[model samples]
Target: MTDPETFIRSTTRMLPVPGVPEIAVYTADEATALWEKTEEQLGQTGLPPPFWAFPWAGGQALARYILAHPQIVQGRTVLDLAAGSGLVAIAAAKAGAAAVWANDIDPFARTAIAVNAAANGVAVGLLPGDIVGTAGTWDVVLAGDISYERDMATRLTGWLESLARDGAEVLVGDPGRSYLARDRLELVASYDVPVPRALEDADSKRSSVWRFRAA
Candidate 1:
């Protein structure tokens, strides 16, 4: 595979998201043209679509909440699981977290996280592979939009529950996806997030930030 960092820098532009103007990210301008440039590099018709190339609604909602309530992460060790675009991790750093780690399995996403964190003037550490079952060492663990899949939500929620049991605060942001088991979570905040028409069917989504309650 080609270097994803180089591909991302060339294909995307740094733009401020519509609602979350405080942070700027390297992302696609339009849905149709998002990954078109990568086609030639892969020499194939379909390459894995880059999730890091856009600011997802769930992540945005979580990030916005964190910024608004800096006390949640201030002076603590924080982790942003499935840290797409490093939005929440950057927000944690900006909110005064002593240290922040952005975890994602995708190499391109990791590079994007590094770039996005730097662009936002925040330094974020990287956890480049899946750390699902591993015990978390941070004070707070944040996940956004990772529960869209059945198996993923099952696996991740189980692990997140464990982290919460160990006394680390676990928070998730989701737009009421099918996989999120709401009964196990406590709603902490809600936002009407504006999403791009191409990404979401609606102009805005009622997204919620949930805290993993005591088991």
Candidate 2:
């Protein structure tokens, strides 16, 4: 298998995120093609899609909100969970976060985050594993587009709730994914986030940012 960075550079183009023009990340031209290409490159089958190659709607929305409202993360330590492409993590750093960590379970995603963060001229620490059930001292925790699956969403929400209770401000950005725990969150902001037609049902997703309520 080729070095992940080399494969990512060959397969994607650095592009500015929609709505958030201050930052850019490596993005694939098409999701399905990239998914297949990733598998072929790794000599693997049934691998997850290359999600780190695109700026998802929820991430874009969250990035826009953070850039617009820099006060949210300014001078605070932040963690971007499932930090695909490091989009939101870059936003936090650009918004003046004291320190930012981009956390993702995928090794490919960790490499992609490092690449994208360097491209965007921000220093971000890459956390390469599942830290969901663990406690951290981040002043702010950001999650984007994470509620797409039933069981995963349930587990994540539980962890996020615990984070909130521990005094970390937890925020979520989502496009009405079926499992989003609205009952445990309060709306902070909303936007019509631009999305790739190949990846979403529509060209734009009405995404919302929510603050997890400590329960």
Candidate 3:
């Protein structure tokens, strides 16, 4: 039997993002270094800490949406919250947003975002730190695959509500995590994403993209 860590590492590299249909933006060199560092730090750790990781299906879905509906992002300042690999942020930039900011607490993610942004031929402002207390005004806020944990989902929903109340549009892409509050969420679009086993409890599952408005 293969070790879970080895399996995870190998599978992560092969994970594909639907709709993008392009190769992984980062080079093999960068990905190798990232995998080594992440495994060294998190291999034994029971639960992986929230970090700037990449190739998440939810993020890809949101990115696809932005690219397909460029009008939603056109001429707007967009915030990609918990931006791992800056996928959604890159899409926002490609979609002609006036400005794009990618925020994440993980330093590795920050570097990845910068590299990915350059790879995608777009400019993304990288913001480091927790977005909960960070204050900035934007026309749109993008969140992807954020509702994995219960507490995290609650916190994120609250933050999103606050931002929505302030007139910022908040869009979340998830695969129906248990923490998502159906009462307040509106289904925008859903997709049958190909997710890696390491990223999800099941081997693979189809996911959904949900959009919400300030109530």
Model 3, runs deviating above 4 Å:
1-16, 22-24, 27-36, 39-51, 201-204
The backbone clash count of each candidate, in order, is 0, 0, 0
Residues 36-72, model 1: lDDT tens digits: 6666666667765677888888898999999999999
Candidate 2, residues 102-197, lDDT tens digits: the string is: 999988999999999999899999888889999789999999999999998999999999999999999999999999999999999999988999
Model 3 C-alpha lDDT versus the unseen true structure: 0.73
Task: Please rank every candidate by TM-score, starting with the best.
Answer: 2, 1, 3
Best by lDDT: 2
- Taking all chains together, the TM-score of candidate 1 against the true structure is 0.93
TM-score of each: 0.93, 0.98, 0.81
Per-residue lDDT value at 132 in model 3: 83
Off by over 4 Å in 1: 36-40, 43-48
Per-residue error at 82 for model 1, in Å? 0.5
Q: How many backbone clashes does candidate 3 have?
A: 0
Model 2 pairs in collision: none
